[model samples]
Target: MEKLLISACLAGEKVRYNGQALPISEPLEEQLSSYFELVRCCPEVASGMPIPRASAEIIDGPASLVLEQKAKVKDNQGHDVTDAFVRGANMALQLCLSNNIRFALLAEGSPSCGSFLVYDGTFSGVKMQGRGVTAELLTQHGITVFNVNTIQEFIDQLPLVICNQSFINADFMK
Candidate 1:
């Protein structure tokens, strides 16, 4: 059976920098919890960031994940950890490749896991429609990704994933 990759924070895991889990869809939680085993990830914290760290913004450019030079995450001298974030993204991709899981349900608006929307990377409080580091890398490699904020939308996509080679061939032909 195909599996889904989920953001650890979304699963209420304490991996978030804030050390808090965002909202979870009860329905998606119930269905996906049973049918699909999840490979959970939190790219930001995974890249050696401490929780309760600075809430960062994406600036410079969205594609490269470069942040504004003056923009620091929080107190205690936050540095631009974009490279670490990229490393975390690579790690998530490794998990997908190893497991052959092509679909991910990330946490929207996070620099690490956001599938649909991310902070402009400027700490500007403005939301832009875009994918995060992990989401971008995953999709670049053909992994379809989602965020649980739209639980119904993702729930509909789950029944369509086919893990085996035969099924993948058949679906590709269609």
Candidate 2:
């Protein structure tokens, strides 16, 4: 089975900044594991950040700017956490490279793992179309990132399979 790097929080690990896990349904988890080996990671935790850490968001610009050191990540308590965020992203990239992981399923709206959209640095619950620090770095290194809402797209790209007498093939739709 192919190895798929997944956000630890999505894999039922309590690694979120709130010390919570956002796991998918049991059946879906089982199905995905049947097809791919899940390699879980929490960039923040890997970077030595504690659980229940302060919530943070990229400030002033997108994740690209954060990677470029042109922007910052500030926690809800108004502390600059850009260094931690960047460190976590680099750690995530190292994990991908070492594991030969080509794909990732990250938690959306996370400062470290959001694949498509992240909180807009306001702490007001506003989200913007952008990748998070880790997501942006992984993508730059050629890793395909997916969120819960788009996992089906990844499944659709898989090779044809016959399971329990049912044909699972995206090519048939084409």
Candidate 3:
């Protein structure tokens, strides 16, 4: 079976910063179970963050800037957590490389896993278009990352990712 990287919280693990798991519909769970070997991770938790830890977001700019060390990831209390985020991202990349994972289905609004949009750095519940640290790194390493909103979307995209070895093989051609 093909392996897939997935957010632990999305896989019904209580690994979110708030100590809650994002609810996964049964159909989605079934699809995930049947289609791929799920390798779940919470970059925040994997980086040594405790469960129920303070919520954090990218600060100053996008996650790319954060990865470049030009920005930060700050908790709601204004404490800097950039190191944890970066470490987690690096670990995530290592996981993909070690496991030969070619795709990721990550949470959509996290500092570590968001693939499309993340919370604005304002701590005011505002959202902005940006990729998260882990997502960016995984993609940079040729892992196709998806911010899936529905089971149907996951189902729809799985075949494309599985069949398209070019995306995964591109890394070796480099």
Which candidate has the highest lDDT of all? 2
lDDT of 2 by residue, 41-115 (tens): 999999989998989999999999999999999999999999999999999999889987877899999989998
TM-score of each: 0.80, 0.90, 0.88
- What is the TM-score (0 to 1) of candidate 3? 0.88
lDDT of 2: 0.88
In candidate 3, how many Å is residue 138 off?
0.7
Native-to-model Cα distance after best TM-score fit, residue 107 in candidate 2, in Å: 0.3
On a 0 to 100 scale, what is the lDDT of residue 95 in model 3?
A: 91
RMSD of each: 4.0, 3.9, 3.8
Top model number, TM-score = 2
Tens-digit per-residue lDDT, 59-139, candidate 1: 556644333223222322456666677777888889899999877888888876777898775565788987777888898
**lDDT of model 1 at residue 9?**
86
Q: What stretches of model 2 exceed 4 Å from their correct place?
A: 161-174
Any runs in candidate 1 off by more than 4 Å, and if so which?
A: 64-78, 157-174
